[model samples]
Target chain A: MAHILLIDDDAGLVDANKLVLEAKGHEVSVAYTGDDAWKLLEKRRPDLLVMDVMMEEFTSGFELARDVSIKFPDMPVLMLTGVQEHMRSDWKFDEDKDADWLPVRKFLAKPIPPTKLAEEIEAALKAAKEKKGKRPS
Target chain B: MAVSEKLKVIVCDDEPKMCSAIKIILDGFRPEVRTLGVEAELEVSLVSTGEELLTRMETDPADLVLLDYKLPGISGMDILGRFSEEKRETAVIIMTAYANIETAIQATRLGSFDFLAKPCTPEEVRYTVKKAAHHLIVSRHARLLAQEKKRIRFQFISVLAHELKAPINTFDAYLDVMRDMTLGKDMTAYAGIIAKCSERTDGMRKMIADLLDLTRIESGQFRRAPAALEVAGALAAAAEGVAAEAARRGIKLETEGAGLLVEADPSEVGMILNNLFTNAVKYNRDGGLVRASAAADGGKVRITVEDTGIGMEKKDAARLFSEFVRIKNRATIGIPGSGLGLAIARKLALQAGGDIEVESEPGKGSRFTLSLPAPGSIDLKAA
Candidate 1:
């Protein structure tokens, strides 16, 4: 079981996703605003984070993800959005840029199937675990 | 009979006599309009302040406003500024007794529809109002046309994005699947999937080709080379292209009533049939039956494709011939298609002096019928 944080401005989507993720045995915490998400991050870190593109302030999620990755580089971030293509174009996917940059582990377009979401979450968790194991003790 | 409609007007002036004179002129004009059997009833409202004029506008919208240039709290130009800011559709005609040419120019800059000098004739007032009404009508229509064009452009961009993304994403997914050996070295199964993916890619290519072709045809860049051909052979070949896909899904694809001849470009006819057959297989239920047939009827050859798949609702069926409209179906998700097949096919058929018809219901599936002129009826050699 994994503890996942979902940050999005859409209240209904947050509730629905929380229900689905919890039902799959993952403990899900949701933040409808970017400030609330930042507070939650300071308190406790989750194994994975799912974020939306547009929040109260435009591109708030993108900014928060970058900050969180700098503070806690180990945590895997899964970015989800309706405008995946738009985001993909804006963020120019590349790994060699900067360490402060939040390397988005995965991206799922909105209205994603529950099965696909679960699969992606599991894959990301497993990869994180293997990378930790490879690190010097 | 056409002249009884009320002429709604708003009069803004600090002076009571100016308002009274304008009201008297309009009231007298109303009776003359009625006598001429014109639908013009004059309804006027008087306001002393610009604020009152703006507030009254919310409840009682007028067709025209007679605004005084000199007023108490706010001038006529100030009211015009408010009108411009509020984006009011009503036309404003500036009224100035001590007409300073400068104030009239300022009023014009502030968007006054027209300017009226003091002690103006009732004839001038009547003619000005009539011209303002005509101007309003023409401007409203132009705005509507501009808005419609913007809406169409937005729709085209949305469709273009979907059309481009679907094929590219499908190609990427298929390439990933092939590279990973997700499906084992069972060459037959591997070959089948690859073939299906390639066919879908081909469909995308053809849709792009058709889009370009239609653009060319509409721009008068394309000329047809029509020929007398066997309709059955062309349709059969198109059906064969999608036969493997149907078979894979356990659907029965059959052709009947062969040996029909038509006067058309064989390649174009084949393309139309290919699109129809692809749609039939793409939208059909697993184990569905698709039948393609052609027959000579009256002076034309009728080719029909009937499928037992997920049918379209009446609303969708109505727009089937329109460009870039895909029937929303659960089974069609993740499948790559531009939704241009039927539109292109219809255009091709029309160019060949033919027409297409569709009969469909939400759950029962659909039948597309194409009617084309019989072979040798039209001069195919020069086409």
Candidate 2:
């Protein structure tokens, strides 16, 4: 199991996701803002990152995700987004087009059931592990 | 097309036969002007004398007028001078048999819109009327566009407020689910973070609500519930809402008032007092004192909230009630607020037949006095 870091400005969502991941036998830590998550990462990086796309600023989540990939390339990030419905069609995240900028193992729309969130986390962790295992170490 | 898109036109000439000719020519050019893409249609009215034209103008003025320079009773130059003197917006085109450079200069000096010679060709009349009609239409469109711009700006603000609120609602729902789960097991590990998040969300929610109220009130759509409210009760309730913050800062909060009654919406008064009290606590030095009380003014009740805190400059207090005007200074840095609280409070007070006034000295303290119509003191038609 992975030690997941849950990051969001919304305290309730952070706590709910923390509980869900903990119940699935994964250790979880939480940060309520981008600044908090940034400091936490610099101090000690978690094994896996579960975060929201909207935080203190509207683009904070994407910016932090990019920063994480630059500093800790191997840490897998699973993003939770609440703005998928409202984003303009042209401004939407295209997996192939935005891969260089948006590097996340998975992206999930918000308000998902707790069990669904836990399931996604497990799947993401397994994929990252398999990808790393095949790499020439 | 709307009625406002019609260009009212009056043709004035003493010779009925000549007036008929110009009227016929103008009527024939209506389609020609329409082809020029002028949305304003010609609304024609005929007046045979200067007196008739003057009387008709007094009742309902036309936007453009065709006046013969040689009219009985009042000369064309006299009519042009009168229009210029009164600053009427009628575009007058002078028609004279003596249409030389001197007359044209005189008419132009007297504020005539254009010159039309008698025995004028239909083609010349067509082009002249076309130009005048286009000017009227373009000016009308400009005015309407300016008004629409204002309306769109207000609508944009309202939409932005709703956009900001959606995420908060989702956050609130998540809190509800977690609270339910907390009761079932040990959730104390996240208790401190949860409390901080709860406080932050509540503050942001209040800011959003304040933003909505200001916009609705400005757009004349806010529904208010007015009643006879006891001053002590409203003051106490508002004070209680900020009591915890005051205690945490070691700031003394006090309220005292007799059975003074003010007729206003309860929620409005709550917003006003909450703004004042919150500012009192947030700006106060640690362990400072905040006092709220009311007194009887002539035909009105004076409710005052005084604070012993870092007061502001006179210039700062002058614009304190303006919407979105947060006073920025060294002492007030990082003070979280929407800056609409005082502005909304003042707006609500004025609507309820009352007003808010403030007095303060830098480094000494500040006091805000809210005066409202005392119960039955004034004719309370509506609030």
Candidate 3:
């Protein structure tokens, strides 16, 4: 089972996602705010980070993702957002916004299903493993 | 809707006396006009700087902003530029003690509602404010009407594209099959070429159909006929429809949740499943797997199509369901598509009181799930 970090501001949504991930036999860590998520990352890095775009402040998740990527380039981030289409088409994340930020690995819109989430996590883990193999140890 | 409520006004002038003079004039005219005139609840707040005016507008979004032409930090024209760029729909009246015709023309160009000379009368302030409010109402309504018209035009174009392309695509596919030994000729040498052409043509056909469906639904022409359907049976048929194409690509198509039931339009549901499956196969790596599964959960059934294909970038994945939007990185240019399939499927799912979702990553794979109400369970009357 993979260790996953799920960050979101909605308490009920976080709880629902935790239950779903746990039921699938994955170890899940929940963070209700971006600060908590940053603190968690400082301790032990998760296998994958599932975060929401709109948080307590504007672009909180985006800023956190940028910091994480800067510190640890290997970690993969999966962004969840309701305004995915708007962000993708209209917003341009350039060097001025965040220097170390790489494109997120996956994006799932709000009201996602448990099975699809599980599938994405599994696929991402597999891809990470393949990348690790190719890297010079 | 009472007329006694005072007209809230915000006055920004470096000279405090000028603001007081304007307020006094407005207060004097309040009692004289009673019938066919607004009972002026004229509350004026005076600010000395343009920055303060901007802050107040951001905080309260006042009904009207009376701005002085000259200010310490930012000029009235600069404020007007920012307000217009932000699309703030507030009535703005420019006031200047030293008035020039060029300044008045420039203020009007910058979208100032009206230009006023300083030491003006109370009647003029009242008339300008009233006229500006009326203009605001009319402009807002006009904008709404224009948006409605644009939406209608988008739907019309989508439908027209679909209606024009369907029959042509069908004919193209037939010609492709006939060119090879798949149907009539025993010419085995050109089988590969014929298969590729046919596949591309089929993709185009599906795209046209998607455009047509999107237009119909957006224009309220498409209607949902929810009925009890064997979910497994529908999956089987849709799979069968794409089986030959999958075989051509050496992809495996499998279904797990047969015999389940769902409440939806059979044709629309089938199209949704078919589009997802086809996308999986067409975009997959050689020998990739395409799996379709369904499960019953309380009052709904969840159907999913999972594939090991050339996945998408996160940005592209976000717009996977918007009409006529395709991922530029994953698009195979020679392979024809109108990029309306997922969007149409999403609309259909919503019409059935359900939703469609996707999960994907670059070079990994993708999965699409459809959550729908179970057949024979939904109350048609309430929905």
Candidate 4:
């Protein structure tokens, strides 16, 4: 089980996601804004970060993601956004762009199902472990 | 200066011959008024009284007026005062046979463009008309430009307001579902419903925030807090941001070439980096690789992101950086994007004396290179 940090402004959604993530046997902590997320980050490094794109400030998650990757290179981020629903488009996330800009591993549309969230979290942890194996000694 | 081609010049006098003489001189004399690729010509209208001139003005305002101080049924001075009160654009040239220093001073005080005595030379009539017409054209152009700016601003605000419909509608739908709840009274059984409600509301909150950010950027009010920082920190921060998403998709996100210093606000630079990095992750193949590496190219420092994912056609890539444009493709149809990310990224990059460049091909991978001004190199303007 991996440690997860969930940052979102909605208390209800945070509680729901926490319940779902914990049910999958992982440790979870939550913050409601980018500032609070940073304060939480100062205390511990989570294995993965689950974030909302628009919170307190638009693109705040993107900012937090940037800070996390720089401060904790090993932590992975899963971005949940409603941006797609409002600005519908045929656009795929491209990683070849600087990691600093598109720092999240996945851009999942919000109102996501609990099963899918848990599954993605599991997949992320597995990938992290595999990445550690491939790193240079 | 060329006179306005359809310039209307009104001549008011109780004496028909006086009006006729002025009309004939103006009709033959073309006023020189500067215009933007448009010729100007004087079209004269003769009125026997101040009331007649004012009535005609109500329907078709003159660009310039030639009025006699004495008239029946309302003095020319009263008409001039009315024009002043109404703030008409028509430039006035006062003409009276009883011209005196006091009357001339009064016409000037009332904002008349020119003052002339009766039986004035035709040359004097022509020159005054020319000066007044030129002033009219310049003010007209200024008004047009201001109106156009207001119209564009209104359109932008409307589009932003329209965008609010999505979240509100989604919330409406969520409420409808809640109204028909079949589960027990305990809220745990309604966790999903509660979650959905929060999601919609959160979406609205986010949309509003993005709108505010766009406004700040466009208004030129976004102040920068530039500091000397390491490019590696930005890279690592970005990598950390997408680590989960990349890992979930089995995509490899690796950052190389650490310790390159750049003069930038970490958050601003981080924003650019996060956008590109997120794009790389979201568009990649299930097991593809995304590599972000920083290097110095001449006097500039660049962080290049290369992805082995489903790329784009050159045509689609060309439109990617424009505001509200999103590439429609089979591979991207299910993806959720604000469509403003790249546009915002490009703006912030340019403001920082840098730019984000893209090279992609269908079925192949894509490469994005972001270049920033190196510290002590390239004069950074206050943005």
Tell me, by TM-score, which candidate is best.
4
lDDT of 1: 0.76
Task: Give per-model TM-scores.
Answer: 0.53, 0.49, 0.43, 0.55
- Using DockQ as the yardstick, the better of models 2 and 3 is 2
Query: Comparing candidate 2 with candidate 4, which one achieves the higher TM-score?
Result: 4
**What's the candidate order when arranged by decreasing lDDT?**
2, 4, 1, 3
Please give the TM-score for the first chain of candidate 4. Answer: 0.92
Query: Where does candidate 3 stray beyond 4 Å?
Result: A1-137, B1-207, B330-334, B375-379
Which docking class does model 1 fall in?
A: incorrect
The stretch of ten residues in a row with the least summed lDDT in candidate 2 chain A is A84-93
lDDT of 2: 0.80
lDDT per residue as tens, model 1, B1-383: 45455657899988888888888877756433323344455688898878788788888888789998888877788888988998888899998888888988888888899999987998898788777756655565578899999999887776677566644544554454445444555666457556656766686787788788668766756566677788767877887999899999998988875667888877778878988999889888899999988888887989899999778778778888988776543344435566777888898899888999999876678899998889767766544
State the interface C-alpha RMSD of candidate 1.
12.4
User: Which scores greater on lDDT, model 1 or model 4?
Assistant: 4
Point out where model 2 deviates above 4 Å. A88-94, B1-216, B219-251, B254-270, B278-343, B346-383
- Which CAPRI level is candidate 3? incorrect
Best-fitting candidate, scored by DockQ: 2
Write down the DockQ of candidate 3. Answer: 0.02
Clashes of each: 8, 0, 4, 43
Q: Which stretches of candidate 4 lie over 4 Å from their true place?
A: A1-137, B1-59, B66-75, B82-87, B95-101, B108-142, B181-199, B218-221, B226-233, B254-264, B292-334, B337-340, B354-371, B374-383
lDDT (Cα atoms) of all candidates against the true structure: 0.76, 0.80, 0.74, 0.78
- Candidate 3 lDDT over B1-383, as tens digits, reads 32544445788899988888777766544432334343445567778899998898887777678899998899999999999999888788999887989999999999999998877877777787767655654565578899999997887565555434433433443343343323334566446545655655576676666666777887878666888888888878878888998898888988878678888888889878888887888788888888889998888999988899888877778888976665542134334566778888898899887899999977879989899999667788665
Give lDDT: candidate 2, residue B372: 90
For residue A94, give model 2's deviation from the true position in Å: 4.3
Worst 10 residues of 3 chain B by lDDT: B176-185
